[model samples]
Target: MPPPPARVPDLTALSLLVAIARTGNVGTAAHEVGLSVQAATARLRTVEQQVGAPVVERERRGRRAGRLTSRGVLLVEWAGPVLDAAADLDAVVAALRPARPGEQPIVLAAGPTAAEGLLPAWLVELRDGPGGQIVLLDTDDPAAAVRAGDATLGIVETVEPLEGLHATTVDTDTLVLVVAPDHPWAGGSGVDAAELVATPLVTRRPGAGTRASVEAALTAAAPDVRAPAPLREVAADTAVRAAVRAGEGPAVLPRRAVTGDLAAGNLAEVPVHGADLGREFRAVWKEGSSPQGTARDLLRIATGGRIR
Candidate 1:
């Protein structure tokens, strides 16, 4: 005979753990899940008590998110799929006879920038076809979404290598430094990798693909030096561009992401002297579950038969 199974924490607390994993800050994750700061803190403490371990590690140099502890990461990985499955069951039970009149659901999970900057036009094109239901969820962590069975397809900014999921390169791109026309960096040919890292700059949040590319490049360019940090992290490309235009700080963004501003003369692209920072956009999904029907057709259309 086996002993009784270990008791798990409440679902709400488990959800808070996953939220903390996503945002990396307890307060922010709490607010996202509609919990007050004190309540969130108490819930987290309760979780810690039950698990007999700390869930997160926080650091503040002014204000920014910190990293999750090993236990917290593990719990998030376990909880995401469970929560998603629960939600699915709820929806199915609510409708009892769920059927769309003329639409199939396409759940697309994407990194923040691509979700906002890239997919709008492509989604418009998709809408013209068979008129399926399109659901877009914004998440910086695409890999988690795929693993949790949340998104039918995912678009990520980097192609470094993600395990568990089958990823195909949809596009190749380079990171470009963008600055206001009047800024000092705008007049130069490009800033060297060392100088760029040394300088203060505005950038996307930590989990963003743009940030990932810059960090990777800086590391490769100067293996001995500490990687650069963002002077400020904004959630949207529009905000980052606005702040750069206002002379807040220089930023490195995808060439495709800021093409319009560069063409309009609202921003100038400064090259990174010693770093290529080339990245690839990938469409990812779980193994053995290739996108089928409309999803597959749209994938082909988006990539134009190019997969790699």
Candidate 2:
């Protein structure tokens, strides 16, 4: 009597069906739906069995067409109205949980040097501002993260133009020679190009931004000097720092990465003639993704009035 307890089809299978209809191929649709082609085909068959009707017509290995039977079509059409109602409900719930008066939840993706150390002070100031909530994700692939909408903002070392992201120069930072306090060079505040070349160095992995910038400067300064034999190669700035701290060997690091150590006398910045190796930091975001409210305010605070 109670309205036949309502017929319910598996949403996952239904979603896959919808994707298949739009993409016109099982393999392509499977990829969109995050399933393998064989799996999608099996799931489609199961849905058809549940409804007692075919929902798709297969052409080639991947090519498919929505072949909803009369009953299946009726069900598919009915899904539209049901989904619209669900969407409206979702909107209502989201609106009910509206952002606190001025607080914005912002995510920033950046290189380890800035994300782990440099940005904390600025972030604290922003947090004291009107509702500035921030999360930082440190990674070397900031460009990819920015393009994927994984973060509202990204700080990176290079100036390469990201295709769909807007980039603005933030500041220029230099690579400083760093060595453990016990190292022989520790007595000196710096080293010359010849000293750098002759030293057995602990360096970053090949493609790192710091490494690239240092290499370019090195080539310009002494094209004839052979590349230093690396004592060790590490992937992250933190790893490189730990290696240096272990007295591995002399290493090159960004000023931001070694600033505290330099200040504490744990490590000294080596002076090198014409070795003012530098790179531009950039703030990047999706081209049309405008920051609003708290995010906009936080961006301003983080940039420290230098968003030009």
Candidate 3:
């Protein structure tokens, strides 16, 4: 590499010298830069040592006064563009900094069910409102993302209350037990919670909101029964639906996710007695922090202006 650059006085010291030249008084320049006169004097001595010449004229008979020598005047003029370029660099760095919530585009983290079924319409409406732009993240744990400040807002489907966050139910969804037309339960009256929990079914991966809701409902309804392992664990709702349509196994999924398949006779919804499969779709944010700017506008639009 090249030789290391030479050390020089920092910007603050140089600016202080320039200020002293402008005001013609050391104490006045010190006050302008929020420094004591004694501290400024020490700093000036350090600057002189670095420059290898006396930059300020010293009075021999009284308190120190700021009177620039010929060298100081020349140094001040040269420092003008250096200080200006430093200021411009500061502005550019600030512009490139990571955006805080509500500062740039609204960052929305959503669970698979909501991302697949709901947010598209709400985002379309937000396009016409004061909300400027949106960056959407499809995640399994949207509430956690919002709580950690990674997302400006979160949409999640759960019956449990979120700790350390504020949540408002914007909509609801139902988990339907679905199977292919050739399955034994396809045309039956329905199965009970015990039987549904005992069967190995196609399911979303462990952290998914859809899987959590179904497991919670099953555990609540049939506390004594042990649930069976999943026939296959898929990553997304569409993949789970595809597995069920291919006769992999029965699966419990968001009704909205399989509406088209159910209507087309490709998948059949089998009822589950003695258990509630309903869940609330909620908008969540950090505790004590209210949505603002684009997030607020999108929330208002999502809730039909009822949440503002």
Candidate 4:
């Protein structure tokens, strides 16, 4: 006997569900899906009923636990081929339609740290290569840009495992515990992970990948060491460094960001015992899509062809 076909979720609903899986917040996912939060909530409820599952979850160890159900994940997987086909169809229709007289340049989306610390230098070298232009779009969610066809290439810093796309590891960084030179921990050889988490270190906001990594490690190594919040939650890397330097508290940040300060005797590093919160810089593009011309050139330059 032939098996029953999988349920066909509404196209718009399925797309919204995928956005929820990507962003992990109904309101933010709603923004990405182009609906108001109220509308998104109602829509999600309808979809949940249609699919017979609860996809978005709740807090886990003081983190946003919103994630996809197995069925919701399946919907994301099923929606991918459809979205790709739609993109292809759009390309064909665009080809048949009258020319718009202006072409959309290739777009690049980069996380804040990578954009500030690394990408600019690499882009400077490209000035000698091509007359072709690339536009920069703002977002921390580089993988989302690739998924939504907003960018031909994207660079993201994330603690979450990379999935559901074609991506490459272009660079790596280690998170170090940085403190003001005069601080008590400065002379210490190392601080245990358990002790560090209990200290309310200066940190990025909850959703930032680096902070997420730190929380995950703390929850695993010593769940009892959890703090009510960060020592301080600042938006910018500069602000985080400034807060740490002001002797407010110690911080865990990428070594690249504070290596100069450490060298200048402004800050000191205390080893983090039992945890190495390493991070990767990824260049991502949509799965099953190929880059041509300048996009290909940029990928070669960015990754040296060693993409993961």
Best by TM-score: 3
Please give, for residues 167-269, the per-residue lDDT of candidate 4 as tens digits. 7878898878899989999988888888887787788865565676667766777777656677789776677888988899998888888989988988899
lDDT of candidate 3 over 152-265, digit per residue (tens): 899988757799988887888789999999999989999999999899989988878888899999999999999978999988888998898989999999888899999999
Local distance difference test, each candidate? 0.75, 0.70, 0.83, 0.73
Candidate 4: the clashing residue pairs are 168-308
Model 3: lDDT equals: 0.83
- What TM-score against the true fold does each predicted structure earn? 0.62, 0.54, 0.63, 0.62
Tens-digit lDDT track for model 1 on 1-308?
A: 23654657777888888887777777888888899978987887787788898776655662324467888889888888888766544432332233357655777778776766566556555555544455665688887898899888888876567888888877677788899999888878788888887877898887787787788887788667665567898987788888888788898887887899999998988878787788877889898786886678668767875554
TM-score of the candidate numbered 4? 0.62
Weakest ten-residue segment in model 2 by summed lDDT: 89-98
Q: List the residue pairs that clash in candidate 2.
A: 103-131, 189-270, 189-271, 190-270, 190-271, 191-271
Choose 1 or 4, whichever is better by TM-score: 1
> By TM-score, highest first, what's the ranking?
3, 1, 4, 2
Q: Find the 10 residues in a row with the least total lDDT in model 3.
A: 88-97
Residue 177 local lDDT, model 4: 89
lDDT score of residue 80 within candidate 2: 68
- Please give the TM-score that candidate 3 achieves against the real structure: 0.63
